[model samples]
Target chain A: MKPAPFQYLAPRSIEETVELLREHGEDAKVLAGGQSLVPMLNFRLARPAVLIDVNSVTGLDGIEVEDGTLSVGATTRQRTLERRLSAGGSGAQDGGWALLGEAAGHIGHLHIRTRGTVGGSLAHADPAAELPAAVSALGATLVARSRDGEREIAPHEFFQGFFTTALRPDELLTRVRVPSWPEGTRSCLLEVSRRRGDFAQVAVAAVVAMADGRVVRAGVALAGVGASTVEAPDVAAGLVGEVPRPQLIAELADDLCARLDPPSDTHGSAGYRRALAGHLLQRALLDATSPTGAAAAA
Target chain B: MDVQQESVVDPAAAGPAAGVQEVTIRVTVNGAVHERPVPVRTSLVDFLREDLGLTGSHVGCEHGVCGACTVLLDAEPVRGCLLFAVQADGHEVTTVEALATGDELHPLQQAFWEHHGLQCGFCTPGILLTAYDLLRERHGVSEAEIREALSGNLCRCTGYQGIVRSIQAADESWER
Candidate 1:
């Protein structure tokens, strides 16, 4: 169970950290909260010659709303984000950022949330991870930095494939910027995992806004059915300027079910994921459109 | 600009060579500061058990699946196995050993005993610390919340009925 030999370096500043990343390049792996990395290290699945510990890097743990975007620093722990979105936390209001709390609660166990970072989960890019789908549904932009400079990549472009990302070996994911919901916009997340806190078999995030009883905007994204969180543009387009009734949601969900072509795995079959995606999206939409504080049916 | 300028880079600066690297870390565990040089791969659980002789935090499923190696890092529950000793540098760690005071067992330990929360006691330490952190952090935690909080710690014995009862009893018996 012991991890292979590696050198650990703790850089005190972001510049020094970037320098370390540029120096080591692909040979070094950045360590955030270590919730996912250390487990892989112990299993000998990840063997980086040098580990650049970013936990000590300054100015990488802030959470704030800047210019209508909820900017989350790279090292912000998942538990911190969860609490901030909970009943009394900062995200309780203003753009429905509290929806992150719902998705964060479904991530692993409480201990894992305490140690897992938002950037770590997104960078890991697990198909079943709930955070990625939630962020994607929010249409968030990921910020990556290297020796050259910084570049902002959208979630759709950032996530390349299974456990693969557009992040270069010399780049460090520095932050994520999620555009806050407009006034009266509501959002919710739903996932059907095998166990209570396990990775989602099919996860969905729904953000919807209505003006004069007609849908003004909608964003729907699904996870666990593809390499990255699958955003339904057609569904979003069909939903605009229409009434979001039960029948309309059902039609959109049916279209989504037909569009997904998930692979079969030990956890579930391709058909099962396709069916699960439809149901999860339906439930998420219902929850988002329902009155606040009224519990959505399971 | 000053902060950026202050970041001096020395390309010739030494880093880990090949695979082996030794680093010194200072961790305050159970109210005592210990400084030691350990391999980069040494997990906090191993460092505590082997070097510091604090075996109260047990190691199970070293890949962080099982919560047997859970400990309070800076007052938050985290799996010690998932963290290298180097990560704990300049941090505070609370283990199961800190739960009792000399001859007197803490209220949580007493509640576990009175409620029969353990049979083999292998998972007790991790459960105890996990419950302790929950009780301290959150006030008036309900049964459902208790179950959710302790969900990470897996207790094969007692089927978690007694463990849940113990935590509830501890909550009621404590002043909080």
Candidate 2:
């Protein structure tokens, strides 16, 4: 497997990466973990003129919690974050910690996870992928910087379309900041894939807050169903101003299905995807709202 | 001007190939540092196997599906097949060869042998380093988590059951 010839530069710091990026301009691609970019190179799918290796950059692989927000550096590898989050070392706030940790545990395999960076995945912007959906569902902020300045993009606005992001040339994602887990809120992610490690045909992430045993706030995001994450505002509205019951989640599922027109992909038939979307959405919502947290959770 | 942070490229030396001009890169692999001039396009897998004489990190599929080329990049497991040698310059990279202190097998390696974690052993190095990275974190990973963690690696021999078991046992008992 041969790739197109390209110049390589190993930059030692983010400032260097930014400078080198300015030097190379649109011809260069930032080498994060290379889990995705390398494959694209081998397949001859990507042919960048220069590669700015950002691995040597210090302070870009850190995960820190500051002032009610969790900030994850763009270069932080997935396995490292999974390990840190699972170990509760990210100092996650209430509802966000457990679910983010749970979601991290479900990403690809050890080797892929070890080398794959969340920023890379976010930058690559695969619509059917998990991290993008998780970030969207959790409403994380995407931060990108270039030689000129930095820009902040919300999850809903970050994704431009399938395989496309709002990031401009010469800009690199620097970090993702997510809201602290709110009180009385529980969340869960349910994904259905034909095989392990394959892209999800349909995946759902749900967050529900209960006040005195009554549903107060809800957020729902689905991946692998559309060009970007399909946020079910109606489904979330269904839960809110109502109570947490099996019937309500089921109703939300039906309403969400009606709202989202899932596209047909190789993984599954369009009809099959729609059906699974409803089913998975219902199940994910129920799991999030579960009092025991073990009932029907896999 | 933001896109021209570095000193302006002289107009006399501008071309498509100029953007990708080859350069020398020095890499520290396993224990030794290698200083050599290679084309900018060569991957790290080729450099380790061909230049440095470290072949333990296997290259399976070459498309990043098989984990045969897994190695530790700055103590983190990564597919060697995917990175360019230029990227590893100045980093402490530990391949499968560096797992043992002397002749003593890394506990994860020992567990794989006793548990029959491998059948043909073609995918062992990839699996070994992957598990090595996973076990580094505390807080008890679950069985389902173990399966998800290794999903990037495809074992053609179908020895995943024992493979998972080996990683599970190693996570509980292995030490640095």
Candidate 3:
């Protein structure tokens, strides 16, 4: 399949990019890594009159950490972030940041990650995508910029529905700000995909902070089970002030399954997704609570 | 749109286009620079095959799922089908055409041949390029790592056994 005829505009700076976005508005689509958008364009699912290519824009690809917050520029490639975290360099050794790396690894394969951008994945808002779930579980802030100005959106507010977001047509996602986890915190992201790089049938992102062998705080988010990344505050709330054990995790997972309302598709039924989410949440909780968890090792 | 930019493809040469959007892209493929005028909607694989005549990168499943059109953009493996020709502007692309010097095949190609990594040869170019990137970037790569890296590139004939063996064999003697 070939993409439809569209005008291409390559803006070299954020100012120029936003100006073009404001000018084109609904008629234009921002081209980030093109991992997702180009495919849609090829399928003719999205036929914008103008495409504002932002790859040439400088200062929109940085990943920096400051004031206990990790700021990842919108266009930062997934592979770049994965490498930084895997190498345990660039302040990526933080527990919360490592969870992102683990999740990024599950986003397609090396080839896709090489070109896929963090912001592109988040802004695309694929329900089964790992980054959105990870960020939601981490309580990350998404920054959006328009000709008017910039505003920050929480994950719950950012992801409106499948393949949709709270982003205005003229606003560009500039950066994602993830707050650092408290000390002694551990996290994990686990998913069940048909293949190694396929979209997850069900995925879980869990963060647990323990002190004196008791859960101080916990965050749980499930993907591939709702209209958007579903944050299970009840499950997280259930674990707080309790000793994290196999029985406790199993009980919480059962509760999570009852609370979920997943879509049934050819790949999996709603019941299957609900059950898988429960299973994954249990494993994720176990991994996050253990000192040698998957995320910690990652 | 800056009109002052170097215009490799003259719009006037298009003979009064009827709403066709075109952009001039200067891309280096296989160490050779080619400046051409391509439609904005032209995928990089189409530009490589139709424009530059580098058909080594085949197009299968024009979407990102099938990696038959994989290539090295700026030394990183990516789906050429997922990128527009204009996106390749100012970027260096390495196609399967650059794998051999004269008659000597690259080590990866040699290994693939030894391991019978291909039965149809349609997916060879993408696999070789993908394996080339994998070998060049990581040393002492495990079989698991190679499999994970090659997951995007699908080969139905070989069942990936020979492909995995080929990459493993190449990794053993792979330098740099």
Candidate 4:
């Protein structure tokens, strides 16, 4: 089936883009990579009157690491970030970018990754999406721009619900800022999908900051268990200053599994997703606490 | 400010009365540049097949799940059905028709035929183009790597054993 008819506009700059948005307001949809929007269009799930293609917008496709904050432009493709992360000197063993690289790898296939943008995925806010969960775990901030001005939104406040975000119709996500990991931080991402490139049935992204082989701080976030990516701050607090072992991890997993309630869909049952989320979190914790070559060098 | 815009299709002819809009896009498909007016809703696959008369790229799942409609946009493989023709304005597109030179089959095509890589042939074009991109980018790819790369392109026929062998054979023969 074809998409519903709409007018197409390609703006050359952010100022022009915001102007177009302001003019069209709720009637316009910003087309970033078009990986998510196009699908919705094809399915007729989204039928906007105007499609503001942001591909022509200048300076919206960059990745910069300044003062330990990784600023990714809204239009930066997943493949670009993945390539940067796995390249020499920033191998998968590296902490900060490696966690994201690992999560990016779990996203759809190479073709999807080639066109899927960081901002599009975040703004689409798919609960089963890996980028949002990883970004949430990393404590990233999303920057939104409109004709009025720009504002930074925390990850928690940014994601509203399933396929929903705090972004207004006349605003566009312009940048995502991911802060550097703590000095001795190690991170891991674990996802359980039906197939290799399918959306995660349950996934976990964890970051562990160790001091003398003990956990000084930790961050845990889950996907595919709720309306949006859920961050488990309480669990992270409980792991502080404690030695990360299989036993402790297993106990936490069991406890969370018993207490948590996950949404049920055709993919899996609520109980099954809760249990799987716990298992993935446990595995992520194990991987995060384990010493890698980069960690040993650090 | 005159933002860059092009509309090839006439709005009236393409269902303007029903609130449908049309856009004229200049696309270079298979080395031929054609300025055509198409409905704003026309996907790259539909535009190539319906407007440009290039049906080499078949549409399977229009929602971007199946790779049957995969094509190269600016040398990178992307889901054609997931991209509108207007999105291809000022861009180069390569469909399966460009894989071979006249009567001479591409090395990947020869390998597929030699290894019995297809049965129904419905999924062959997409698999071929995707494998073409993979071989062009990476050298000496292992069988496991080939399988991983082909995971996105689903082939219900031949059980993918022959398909894997075909890509491995092409990699060996083409790399030499």
DockQ: which candidate is best? Answer: 4
Ranking of predictions according to TM-score: 1, 3, 4, 2
Residue-by-residue lDDT tens digits, candidate 4, A1-298? 4777777788999999999899898888888878789888888899887788998789898888878788889998888877776424343333755667778888899888888888888988999999898888888899999999999999899999988899998899999998877778877788889998999999998888888889887878899999999988777877888898779888877777776678898999998898788878877888788876332223
Q: Please give, for residues A37-65, the per-residue lDDT of candidate 3 as tens digits.
A: 98888889988877888888888997898
- TM-score for chain A of every candidate model? 0.96, 0.93, 0.96, 0.93
lDDT agreement with native, every candidate = 0.84, 0.77, 0.87, 0.84
Instruction: State which candidate, 1 or 4, has the greater TM-score.
Output: 1
lDDT of 4 at B25: 83
Expressed as tens digits, the lDDT of each residue in B57-172 for candidate 3 is 99999989879999999999999999988889999999999998889988888989899889999989999988998888777888888888888898989899999998898888
Show pairs that collide, candidate 4: B7-B24, B8-B23, B8-B24, B8-B37, B9-B37
Model 3: how far residue A79 lies from native, Å? 0.7
Task: Summarize candidate 2's per-residue lDDT along A1-298 as a digit string, tens digits.
Answer: 3787666667777777887777787899888988788888899899888777777678788888889788899888786777677524555446755555556556666667777787998888777777877777677899988889888999888887887888877787899998875587777888898887767888888877777777787777888889877777778777776777888788778877877778886788878888999988888887777876664465
Model 2 TM-score is 0.86
The fraction of reference interface contacts (C-alpha pairs within 8 A across chains A and B) present in each candidate is 0.53, 0.53, 0.58, 0.56
DockQ category of candidate 1: acceptable
Candidate RMSDs in Å, in order, are 3.4, 4.0, 2.9, 3.0
- Cα deviation at B155, candidate 1, in Å, is 1.1
State the lDDT of candidate 4 residue by residue for B1-176, as single tens digits. Answer: 55654453455554322454666789899899999887777889999998888988999988888899999999988989888888899999999999889999999999999999999999999999889998997778898888878888988878999999999889888743
